[model samples]
Target: MEHVVRLEQVSSQLLAVVRRRAGVRELSKIVPEACGIVWNVVRAQRVAGAGRHVAVYLDDQINLEVGVEVSTPFAGHGEVIGSATPPGLTATTTHYGPYQRLHEAHEAIRQWCASNGYRPAGPNWEMYGHWKDEWNNDPTQIVTDVFYLLVADGSSS
Candidate 1:
């Protein structure tokens, strides 16, 4: 498993709301659909950051968190109707090929963290950098960035 950690500039976003009780199947159903709709109709760009953190957050909602946010940059004016921004400081990685294969990308990060003696922090995120459902006819061309926040020393896994 390869691992990289980096800092990101902070940003803000306006978001549409959706709520779901905690669980992978539930999240899987809700998030992909919401993101797909937002991507196809709204034409939003994918957010960047780490992957593991998002998974941990999904599994553990210690803090209030949003998943797979859709956004546009801040223009210092009234918020655009469909514009949005995700909180920054995420660990991000591009997982190519089918979206289902993203599970491996995430597993790589988790293994990297364990081998390196690092703990994951709060909830992480996944941003769809590119989704060309029409052209590719495969989710492989779909690019997703997953984020996992780091935990302090001696934290729980």
Candidate 2:
């Protein structure tokens, strides 16, 4: 039930931020709160007068030496911050289910990319669309788009 999809070039303006170090155990607790921190900034933008979406891009591996940075101004305590931009190419797909299943969709895209001779460049970010109402529970109604930044032939820029 998975398929390959193309992504039109997109550039997003995001507040800078730095992600704090966390293991799988700590991630379960930190990620949600970090998302909230970012979301609050998104909401405030709406309150001010912007009508665009903001997303956080994470890298697969953190450089313990260099650390990370988020461009988004909103940040959690001790977060490494920088603005996220799309790499030149990406393998994009839509995930229609609860947020919990996002990992499954990501794995599907990752495998697809590998089979097709593409390697992942960074952590894919989910672009949120319309707010979910009761339909959130219905896998058929829920819609989440996943984008994997890709590097063809695994070349480093």
Candidate 3:
């Protein structure tokens, strides 16, 4: 996919998440498991303004936070804890297609950063857009925004 990667500054966001450490190969399984648990908590708590599901990838070993957006930090239940994505400069892009092709957006950002002089700061996340029923008619209409935090100096730390 041709991603229109851009640099921007973002503020922190609160997420009710279940954290885990896993390899890339395990994401397909663990992500859903975590998201499901979080969703149950959000519903039971009636957390307001709960929004799209998010998967935050923290490091090389892949410390992960999978959950939905919450309005504020709350008393967490079990593994569903109050967590936040960092505020900083980032390389971001929007992907329009099926989730399976979402990785292409990440790759696009990585390549853009490499060629344009920037370094990943070890955390990246995917923010899934609210689903549209029409997407079932054309999976290519699905939307996801990908973000990679960048080092302050845009240099490898």
RMSD of 1: 7.1
Which of the two candidates, 1 or 2, achieves a greater TM-score against the reference? 2
TM-score of each: 0.56, 0.63, 0.93
How does each model score on lDDT?
A: 0.47, 0.54, 0.90
Ordering by TM-score: 3, 2, 1
**For residues 26-69, could you state the per-residue lDDT of candidate 1 as single tens digits?**
65555565444433333343333212112224456422233333
Looking at candidate 3, the ten consecutive residues that score lowest on lDDT are 148-157
State, as a TM-score between 0 and 1, how close model 3 is to the true structure: 0.93
Candidate 2 structure quality by residue, lDDT tens digits, 1-157? 4644664455544443335555545544555566565445545544333222334446545211111223443343334344554555777887776656667777888777766777777656665446557775565666767777776455533
Give one digit per residue, the lDDT tens place, for model 3 in 1-157. Answer: 6999999999998899998988777787888788889999999989998989999998878898899998878679877899988889999999999887888999999999999989999899999898799999999999999999999877743
Error of 1 at 70 (Å): 6.1
